[model samples]
Target: SSPLDPRYTFENFVEGASNRLALAAARQVADGSASGVKFNPLYIHSSVGQGKTHLLQALTHRLKAEHPEMRVLYLTAEHFMYRFVQSLQTQSALAFKEALRTIDLLVIDDMQFLHGKQIQQEFCHTVNTLIDGARQVIVAADRPPVELETMDERVRSRLSGGLLIEIGAPDAATRRSIIERRIALTAQHMPGFSVPDDVIDFIVRNVTTSGRDLEGAVTRLAGHNQLTGLTLSLTMAETTLKDLIRVTDTRRVKIEDIQRVVSKHYNVSKQDLLSSRRTRSIVWPRQIAMYLAKSLTLRSLPEIGRRFGGRDHTTVLHAVRKVEEMIGSDEALTQEIEVLKRMLEA
Candidate 1:
């Protein structure tokens, strides 16, 4: 009834290659005997629709069910701000503080919205009081603490001090599994509707960004099939979701644009990426920038290298190769590059 309530407990969460480590960490924290056993103030960050809120809610619900005596409070950033503002207006700040301080577990979702100086100050005070009093705090956001722009330094530092975990976008296998799970759930609602495996594969391949997109596609397919008395087919699904599938336009991002985006993301001068500095940080970003430049632009290696501070074509080749390997192996790095690519294209 309510969008399938994504908060699956640890028992229901499907383990896959994409989120095995994160699931383990969450389980450890939830089952920890004393406060701060495995991870205190667990911070989960991910892009939209990657199950961050689901995991946070699941943890909160599981803890409350297991320990009936523990007090838990869960609120989104907007709700938290609203309550804080209302308390100030009604002269009830102390009451709000007291209620929050007495909770055994505090869960905040979409914390990136609370970036104002005043709100951040209040958040810092709340965090300090809860941690000092040995209460567990869990926060979710779209980005990590260090990357949170406009947030107070004290709040950012405190958030980063705890265990920080990031959930990556679902890979092809994970997406396929998600598609199957959603289709099965949909079948429960619509007994006569069915989707073929090829259709599922097609949806997974095309909508490869996030789990939310996949679920939306499945729901749309189920609804259309029910309304029109039509069988779900690959062609129909494609036609229905033409806008959701992102087709890269080679003309949009040029080599120079890629370099500019990468430089800005890393906060390094364009010359640094082009320079012969073998530092790990610079080297990886440089390679990724070059790889994106070559992939997105019509420029040759020599031309791209020349644009990046007169480096040799062979250097550009090496950087491209290294980045390709890293993207295939390192999930976090792949997501970082994908985010940069999205920004560059936008």
Candidate 2:
């Protein structure tokens, strides 16, 4: 049986600006437009804990519901390799290929796992066969196809050949909606349980990482609400989610630590950040590290710049001020930087 999670259906999915476009495209594919298999291999990319798995599983469930007669295969890249290897061990390699090729719809989650030479060839063959047969295919990964460094050019090109969609980090309003939906879902099992609007807003403002963190926040709040035998309030939320919300939870962050964290979170090389790669990718994360280095450390702008590629004090000061100004006005940027800060502190 397919490992599709029923809880991840479209009904339970809370649509927001961040995921609206991806959700719509997934819907169009799920409904099977007569215009033909237009968006073959719908590649959805996003950061970890963001709803890639949810959307992939939701599409599988919808396809199974709409067309029961269609043969649908939903599995991760690891599981696919497992099955393929099993078929070889069991002397059913040909049968395995036949089964994979004949499916009406094929969906693979975490496509980044299809990186090795042999595995990429096998998976690429399967995808090519399916696409040639007019069968719909969908894949999800943490980065875009072009950014998949481990994958070969042939497979990477094929993955990018399809419509690529990137799901951005959820904004504050989206986080609030997610919390509300999570609360409603929890109420189904824990009747008479609820979180106050203020608490939800507090969580929405504070827990700005991912949907998974939002789920954790609600779970903790509900548990606390039950223990206290009263509504969850702002005060309780502040105390209960203390570690989650507090950016200063850890000791003073070192300049080295800030650079490593910012580089990793932004998926850029640490040396690139220290180097003079003024490209948007390198510059943004460098500025973020500069900002964090200033805010979280007692070091001055000149000191921070000295640590970061021996840049001028004015550069570090500008970076700090820029991040501060963006955090105030840019809701999405604020959420992203907040998540990075929280991850670093934790």
Please give the TM-score that candidate 2 achieves against the real structure: 0.72
Per-candidate TM vs. native? 0.72, 0.72
Clashing pairs in 2: none
> Candidate 1 residues 40-59, lDDT tens each?
67888877777777776676
**Per model, how many backbone clashes are there?**
0, 0
| lDDT scores in order | 0.78, 0.82
List runs of model 1 lying over 4 Å from the truth: 1-8, 33-38, 247-346
lDDT of 2 by residue, 1-346 (tens): 3477779988888899999989998888778762336688788988666798998888778888888998888889888888888898999988988998998888889887764687778888998999988888889987788756568788899988888888876899899889999999999989988887788878888987678778888999889877878777798889889877643322235567888888888899989999988899889889989998877766667767778998999999888898899999999999998887777665
Report the backbone clash tally of model 1: 0
Worst 10 residues of 2 by lDDT: 245-254
